[model samples]
Target: MEGTAKSLIEQTSESILNYIITNNLTTGDKLPNEYKLAEEVNVGRSTLREAVRALVSRNILEVRQGSGTYVSENTGIVDDPLGFSFVKDTLKLTEDLFEIRYLLEPRVAALAATNATDEQIEELDKIRLEIEERIGAFSDEHIEKDIEFHKLVSEMSGNVAMSNLVSIINQSISRYYDYYTSNRIKDETIVSHREIMDAIKSRDPILAEDVMRIHIVTNRRSLSQNKKNNLKKE
Candidate 1:
């Protein structure tokens, strides 16, 4: 607890984030220099520089060789919402991504059911409940959690190489998952997750595979729905 509190209090990155948020800063907005920021956050200039570097790695800010630091163009003000890289470049290519996930994840679920430990199943249950609790409230905000649940299942399947592959795919498709989950008026995902969980708990590999297949199909249907909605708007 002490460590957690101290970490929170000393989080220079978080202080910078709060400053940007409270000031309603936009992309391309020039932030104050390190000295000024250090004074404002009550941190040393070195600490402020470190935080800025971290944000730069996350694509939230940019520093030119000679020019002062500025908010990145892709940081959501002059670009896609929430700094979505996919939206800024290839939003229409997500169908290919979903196609691949559908091809891969059913097999992952089957393997997980066959190989996972009881403790791993418990972790799955805990994650599912957390997702359910957050349903209808910032549904898209927990995209990372949703990705994590699937990643955990993949890792628990006792197939390290496959787990690594799934992790890569998860990172790539995360933005789409966030956008997809947020746009839906009804979250059918919780039910789909429950079915997969039940199959895993029963240790029925075939059943788990079949349920997971259906879950991916359901996601495709949601994607289709979103496409249709977009057409209607146009």
Candidate 2:
């Protein structure tokens, strides 16, 4: 009887989790009322509460007094590992990181275009302006601001998983950053950042996606050119 009850509660918890995912619930979104949720998951009220408690423990849900359960803001990503830090070959590591960024960031940008509020877009522009200023003055803080711009773009995407994942990369792995900052590259980077910001601000997802792709491709090309020039001098 004890084992059967445990299994039932586990199954109920999983069903609740699937419901949240299938519905695309984001942070702060309210879950169904307890009675409705219990009925939907084919569990009794007591078992449903137990399952909810389990999810709350995992930082996946939170209960508010006199309100309702909501998707937790934390989403459990804070302590996730920095994947590229263990990589030994900096060159290969950067190449891999670029590939991941290429695959993920354009979509992130597009989502940001669709989801970003006017206030968030304005904040993003502020970050972009700060980056341009620091870069022009050759202040190393520009590096931090550069990553800040990307992190803001990620946050605007409205996808908690992608936002947190990108934040992890920006905060931990800057292997490819600052490797190729020639005069031409800096000028082009400023232009590319502006293009990306403009696209998102206009709420044009397709444009956002295209410009972001171009931005990454331009950086890849600059890295390649620098490598070739270095090899020639060697």
Would you list the clashing residue pairs of candidate 1? none
Encode model 1's per-residue lDDT on 24-137: one tens digit a residue.
Answer: 888889888778888988887766777788778777788987788888864622223233364544445566667878988999999999999999999999998887776757
All candidates: CA RMSD (Å) = 13.2, 7.2
TM-score of each: 0.59, 0.64
Against the reference, the lDDT scores of all candidates come to: 0.75, 0.83
Model 2, 36-80: lDDT tens digits are: 999989989999999999788778889999999999986744343
- TM-score of model number 1: 0.59
Cα lDDT, model 2, residue 144: 81
- Candidate with maximal TM-score: 2
The regions of model 1 sitting more than 4 angstroms off are 1-89, 176-186
